[model samples]
Target chain A: MISPDHFQALFDPRGIVVAGASTHPGKFGFVALHNILSCGYRGEVFATNRERAEVLGRPTVADLTEIPHGKADLVFVCTPATSNPEVLRQAASVGIKAAFIASAGYGESGEAGLELQLQLVEIANELNMVIVGPNGQGLVSTPSSLCAQIVAPYPPAGSIGIASQSGNFVSSFMNLSRQSGVGISRAISVGNAAQVGILDMLEYFADDPKTSVGLVYAEGISDGREFANRLEKVCQRMPVVILKGGASGLGARAAASHTGSLATDDRVFEGLCRQVGATRASSVAEAFDIAAAFSTLPAPRGPRLAVVTTVGGWGVLAADAISSTSLELVHLPADLRDTLDGLLPPRWSRNNPIDLAGGETKDTVPAVLDAVVGHEEIDATLVLGMGIQSNQGRLEREGPFYPDHGLERIVAFHDRQDSRYADVALAASIAADKPVLIASELAIGDPNNAAVAAVRATGHYCFASAERAVIAMHRLYERTVWLESFGEPNNERH
Target chain B: MSRTLSESDSKDLLAKYGIPFLPEVLISQADHVEDALVGMTGPYAVKLCGPNISHKSERGLVRLDINGVDAVRQACHELFDEARPEDGATGVLVAPMATGLREFIAGVSVDPVFGPTIVFGVGGVLAEAIADVTVRLAPLRRYDAMDMLGSLRSRSLLETFRGEPAVDLEALADLLCSLSDAAVGIDGLESIDVNPVMIVNGLPVALDALVEFSDVEVEP
Candidate 1:
């Protein structure tokens, strides 16, 4: 168990000290100090440097005791590995409870580095100080408006906790958050994991009120028992999306002749995922996609899903993806199909996808969407008609490209139609407590695209393609189906 | 430093706890083979044993489908005397040959940190290619066993397959529970691999089992 005193201080530090503060730009020390200041941390900042009296417009002290703010709550150590022992010793003497070390060449380098890292952990334990990394990147807590990492794209605040072994993913996830509507609550790159591992941070996130979904990228677990035990507890509350790595080479090794050899460590990890209620994804892209779906939608009641599409081809593609997952699409219900037949034209075919046919009127798409999403038999709905060109009435009037009297006029007319269509889907989704996922060829995977961003802003989701949308729908339902067995949840807070 | 219980002793140990092992008898000499098969019905399986011989099939030390009593005697004599010196055995085991519609593998694998872990899955060559399996930490409850079966990729094997009824879940659960109890109750047990727990009609009977002990010696 982690100490509550250190956990609270490291997360929401009231005072921060930059031990290796530098005036020169682009160095880790300078960027570490710069990020803390730029993110508007409410805590007091103390910069300590030996070469100069001040750095980066803040007065620097040669020693930690010179700070007038008394003992800082947390310290960000950005010095070399050879000098970190002395630096941390001085900080611990000043009653600092937590530290985020953003230096490298400690544990990951080799034998010499490993011994130094062990010594650092020993000092940390003796002083009761929680250290993030001795060879790690930094971390960020949106609740306190703190960004102590040098990674780019400090995303805007939202609910989703990320704990990763590779520090690069921390920055990459931040970039993904910028593209997708889902934002992060906390991000930690647990390098080396001398004391605090992925399971510990996951437990903290499970208890944290600010985070509703967890995204973790792990290479290997040193303690399988602690991992499974902690995972069981964490899964009882919030859902965890895991992306396990390092299996391509290990699977190629020579195998034993025993029948039990069939179950490798990675395969057992998949079993562990089933035993513990966590969703496993094949790639980081899928992990983020799963997190985005969970962050926006409620746990589906079951794996029964429906796909409502304007294009006949998309519905078939989506149906295959649904069946591939743990989900199934029964034939359109009798009563619901009857209602949909009324909304669709006479030319519409009869099927579960309920394709709106090529000659669909504007009313044909929205009417089927509402009826399907509201049906009790359906657990979740995926609507795939958010196209940019000709999706909003190519027949009623000449499209923008027909005659762009002016660029502004063409875009103005397109925006008005886009919002009108978005409102229909959003209102139908909000009308029902069930989740509604949107798909489009044009409005996908880009938050900067106002057409897609506006839909997401309304608490609705838009995926890049029909296949992706269908996959997300299937994952969301499975997470819900898994959580269903853990008894009733508090509510869909996200 | 370590010890290995013979097949007969391991079956005796499991039989005490109500695990469904095939009825078998141990013979110290070839002359005792016929007397041991008095109550048992044909066909019979004859397996030669030695202290160092763990995998009998790979070394061609096992004879199956011996229908008549004379055939059983000839097979047993050849396995013990006609084979190489390494294949010569101090004892032989004879059991009733059992037929089944489905095959399963269940056992205990000792993990360094978590101790014994219970594993259940499909058996035979398909076990590796298909990789349909599930694992639970020892001390499994009724639901854990049931969930273990349901978690397999070929979970349909639990349902009606090829005109055969599903294996009795209650009996399978009881077998797994007993297996778990034995694993947890025993000390210095390295691992146990019970393969081809063949299911006939709806009842399961364990046909073969291999138990290995850890090298670390305990005071007890």
Candidate 2:
């Protein structure tokens, strides 16, 4: 596990040096350097390439001796496994407290590689240096604008801390989040997990002030009891979402090959996931959505929920989603029904979905929201097909308008309507201590629409699909239910 | 690679920790059959006891539903005749033929990574096919046992289905916890399979059980 002091040095480094930064873009060192410089990191970064005088625009030093070594906090070892021990020795001499090793050919390559991995860990331990990965992609800390990873461009910066085992999955999750406008706080790919595992990352995330959520994509865990104990502790402070791969015999073998991780029966893992309070997401996208909901929205007090939708079909679809999750589309109380009777059109479906059935206009969204979230019986609300059509319709209409006329007027009008509806929905959700998930037909289609982006900027997720929104709400409820089942004590975390 | 303990011995082992097995007696000779059946009810099940015979009924070493002393003696003779050199039968044993509205399998197996784990599910002939089972790490708390029971896909079997009364889940949980305690506590114990535990009037009664000890040499 990365210690508290080391987390600060590794994630929020004031000064960083890339040990093998390359002049060539094709090399891993160059990719690592370019990501940090392009992400607008406020901290100073030095490139150490013996073959080159400079990397990108930054001046290159032959070694740590060229710079004030004691001041550099983190060193990215963009070198081979064979040279990592010497780099560790050099880094330890410089007083570097932490490092992210992007080199593979560690334990994943077999017996010999496992020996090398042990050597690397031994060196780091002796030097008191926190090592993130032996065979990892890289690490990214959004709060510090530190994109030290060698993958896709940095994801939109926010507060969801992600720790994934597969580097490819981390990049894919970031790309998906980028498209969905889901912001990330910190993400690390714990390759081989020779030193840091899911539990260690989760513990660090717990102490992270900027991180209120921990998301992990793990293939396997080394110790079941230790993992469970740490997970239960971390969950008390911040909601943790885990998406495990390798559920099958063949898949487990694959996972073992990829990360040198021992595979437990998936069923046992499920039992442990329930025994602890972490919500298990079945897919990468679901993990992102659930983490976003748990981090942004207040957990639902109960499983009872209400769906308010402009499109009746979407409400029905959301109802199906609610059924699949541990949520109920319960009947509204008489008092809430009376309020809705006064607000919604007479033709609106007098059911739990509260379908507008084509009777709603953009102006009526506020009152419709007031009645839906206003119910004491409802624990959470899913507002589907709300004012999403405006973004897509406006974009298409103004696509070739006035042969290059100013499009700000149409965009502003759309933002005004979307923001107005969003405010009403969020205010009620906040006041009632319940979450309001918004999904629209067209705007939700983009998922990262300007309106959705504006709403997500507030930290809450507004999904394009009503089903995902409902599923996220259900996951939040499940997390609360699991915690409640444990009767979490005040001092649950150590 | 482990040896199976005899039925009576296995029952004794489980009874030490509060697993309720049916009343039975081990008789090395047919003359002791009538005496052994003294406390048992009218219907009885006679089986050939062995150190290595794991499946008595499948090996034709078992005779069930014997009502009279003559029938009991005939069953004893038949079981002895059926026993082969490999059957490993050393004596005849008689147990009360337990009847119940439901059957369940409660046992423990050693998982290579997690160590001992408790298994609970529907039992009898359909156990393998129904395969509606749930597992929890052994040395389970009462709460863990209850959760395991509730998590079974065939959980409805424990409820009052049709006109049959619901199986006493609290009692089942106790049985599971006891087995888990043994699975975790005993160093020599490798696995225990108590199949078709008869649920007589909602109370679980072990009708048949097999306890296997680890064959691996323990480090001195």
Candidate 3:
């Protein structure tokens, strides 16, 4: 294991230098340097180019040794693979502790590239510096507001930390974060993993104070036992959601070509996840949703769940989703049913879902949510179709009768009420020490919906569908169960 | 590079590690059948045992449900006669016929990446077709063994089945742990296949076992 200071240098460097800074708009050298300076990275920035010139309005040095001593702690290597060894040696001489090599043509490119990758590892080891990727995308550390990657869209700063074996998936996750407004603390793509691997980044996340949950995308594991051991240690501190890529024969072959990875048997990998108590997601979307839930919600005490829905179909969908998981859809006890009956219409379903049946008054949704989330038998509550009011309000505001009928005031009131419902659900969940997952298609269909905005304002993700909400709750419940297996309390992390 | 142990030798090696096997006796000649059955019960299965004869039943060298001593003697003589010259037939193994309502397969195979892994699941002739199993890395903890049993998709079979008691999970867990121990302790061990681990009134007993060794010499 590397020292904490080394990881800190990788993630929270004081100053940074781009090895191959360029003025051309097409080159990664330009983009990497542009993203760092543009994303509000408050540090000393330097560039090394073949010729001494100004790039991105910053004077470029012809070599790394030109940088003053103790000025730059990290280097973003954009030079080709053949020159990386000399670049690393120069960076080491100048007191740089970490390097993110954005250059390709390394281990994934075959024999000669593999040899070059070995040289890079030897230099990293000799210098005792963290080398992120020899053929990978860049990384992001929101604490420093550093989006040093060559990609666009730096996500909002939040708790979920991501490490992926593939660069495109990192970009995809960041894109989801940008669209959904669920921020990230740190994200790195360990391409080819010449010097630093996924486990190293994950362990760093485990010790990182800003990160509450970890999302990992792995195509292969070089050492199964070591991977399991390190992963188990990380899970003890925070929940981890994993998405494995190469689980099938065809996928394994593809992975072998993609990153020179050897895929283990998918079943064994599945069993290993279960044994280590890491939540395994079947898709990238599912992995992010699960990680979002872990980042925001408290672990549930048990599997019992209460579904509160505005419509019957969402409730039915939530119920159907619950049937496939270990989560139990609790039967509404008589007392809770009576409480909901008092708060809802006579036609409302009195069962577990407690469907409002379109009969909710202004206060009905919030009052019913409080009653369900506060119930003793319910470990968590899933509120479905929450943004319907705001969704409807947007539609009516677009019509011709908007201001003529005093519709402006009515839409404003509807939006406020929708936002209030989100606040009340979140508040009630905190008061009851349970998880309340709010889901609506409007989260994805209409990102500007009031309820969606409200949930995002509090730094919690509003799930796109009932099934996605159910999957999140199920993962939370699994984490709780795993904690109990170690005789640890669920709320200890909180 | 690897050689399979004979049925009698496999059972002997596994019995040393606390894997329960039915009481049986080995006889080199048919004349010793009556004496070998002195303490054991009748209604036995007699099979030709040899280092090279790994699939005795497939080769029609196995006879079951012999009641009388003369019947057992006749079955042993027929089994020995049925053995071909290349079979390298060394002896005959006779064990009392045991009945059970449920069968399970438990074994240890070295995974290329994960090393020795324990596999447990539904057993019998359709075991391969059913393909219902779960694995855990070797040197399993007690809880890991329990998790393996619980993880099996056919886990319901371990419950009380057809008026018999539920499988003794503690003993079964112990068996799995012992297998894991052997996986780590034994030298040059390639694999161990214990199929049809019959559940009799809830207790598990290994009815058939095949232990393979690689790059090592062992007496047949």
Candidate 4:
């Protein structure tokens, strides 16, 4: 059990010290100091080095005790493995409560390194300090404006908190957050997690006021029952999205029975995930997309989904995608059809997809969205082909026609209309307390598409494909069912 | 070392946990076959039973659909004759042949990571070939058993098929719960394979069972 003070010191430190501060740009010491200062961390910063008097415009001390107060909340250690024990002893003496070991050559190297790792864990226990990693890439706490990692691409601040076993996957999720405009509250790589593991990070995220969803990437679990127990407890409070790595390895035991043969490690993990309510993603992209949905959307009330598309094919694709998931495509109720009838042209396909069939005016899409998303029978809505107008506007701007042909006004109108449609659909979803997923090929094909931009402006992702939208909706519906099974009210449907 | 128990002993241990099994009697000699068949009805399935004989059907040590006293005596004699010296043949098990439209499998296995897991799936000779099973860690809650049954790919087979009533899932869930209890409560228990749990009328009956024990010392 991690205490609140230790958790706070690790993430929201009042002051941080760089124990191995260096003048060379290539060393981790330099980069660690550079990131903390550059990321606008709202805390006091100190540095310590054996030779250098000053580094990165901060005065350095030979030892932590030389500082005025002999204290700092956290220490980012960029020194070698052999120097960590003494550094930790000094930090403990000075009242530092947490340390992020940004050094390697421990635990992943060999027998000697494993011994050193054990020694570090022993010292951490004696000191009662929360240690993040001995060979990890680093971490980012966006709420503190602290990007203390050794990597680039600090994500915008939002509701998703990520903890990964592999450092590169942490970078991968942060990159996704940058691309999709889905921000992260905190991100950490628990490399060789000797003290503070992925489970501890998840528990912190579950209690974090800034985090609304937890995203995890795990490769191996040492204690399966404890993992399941903690994961289920976290899921009860907030949705958890997990992507398990190294799943193909079968159990090595020479089984003497059929049940033994069938109980592979991966299959058992899958069962554990099902028993708990954690949404297991098949890929990194899927995990981020699901986490983005969980962070942005309200909990759907039921499995019933309504697909509203600008074109027939996308709607048909979404309907086909829904067949394999637990979500249902209900027939449009008469009142819903009548309401859409007043909004769409007479040539529209009056069905569940509510295909506009090229009959939508500037006001048609938003009005149709309002009617479909606000219907009592619809638990969720998927609006497809949202960027068609913006895509057309781009084509017109690049064509032979000039501004002399009134092209500028027409393009502006198209862009404004697409943005408005995006805004209206999102508002309707929130007003009705249901998930509204917008999908368009232009989201990926044209990065500047107005609808996608508008959706991202509000920190939500516009799924690149209708199928992806369906997958996200299916995950949301599963979360709702899981919550209902426990007789717990859904995540306050915001 | 670990060893697998004979089918009769396995059934006896599991039966104590409230797992339903077909009524059968063990006949040690050919002279005892008539008395063992007194209350039981034939056509009967008679199989050679011992601590060493784990797979009876694969070795052709079983005789099924045998009717009348003479046929039962002849079947028991043949099974006893087929038993090798190393097989440590103890007796022959005689039970009325069970018929059902659908067959299901349920059992328990101790996972290396998550110990004592319960398995439920389609059963019969094709159980391994079909490879349709769902597992839950024990001891199972009633809902976990129900979820296991509902999650099988062959779940539709549990519904009414060929005029047979839909399997009484509540009863099956209870059976699974009992199996889970046995998994958790039994000492030295390693694995259990209750194959071909025949759905008779609407209830599941364990027709064949195999239980393996771990860390048991072999007698000199």
Query: Which candidate achieves the best DockQ against the true structure?
Result: 4
Pairs with steric clashes in candidate 4: none
Each prediction's whole-model lDDT (CA): 0.75, 0.77, 0.84, 0.86
- Cα lDDT tens digits for candidate 3, B100-130: 9788888777665666677777777776677
- Residues B116-193 of candidate 1 have per-residue lDDT tens digits of 677888887566677687877777766667767767778878888888897798888888888888778777776666
Per-residue lDDT tens digits for candidate 2, residues A163-262, read 9989988887788667666678899998888877767888888888878788888886656566777787888777888899985343221110100121
True contacts kept of each: 0.21, 0.07, 0.24, 0.46
lDDT (10s digit) by residue, model 2, range B47-124: 888767776766777788888989999888887787778756578888878877688887776655556667777877
After aligning candidate 4 to the native by TM-score, how far in Å is the CA of B115 from where it should be? Answer: 1.2
Prediction RMSDs, each to the true structure: 3.7, 4.9, 4.1, 2.6
For model 2 chain A, the run of ten residues with the poorest summed lDDT: A254-263
* Predicted chain B of candidate 2, TM-score versus the true chain B: 0.93
* Tens-digit per-residue lDDT, A196-240, candidate 4: 899899999999999989999999787778888899899988889
On TM-score, the candidate that comes out on top is: 4
For residue A404, give model 4's deviation from the true position in Å.
3.6
- The predicted structure with the larger lDDT, 3 or 4, is 4
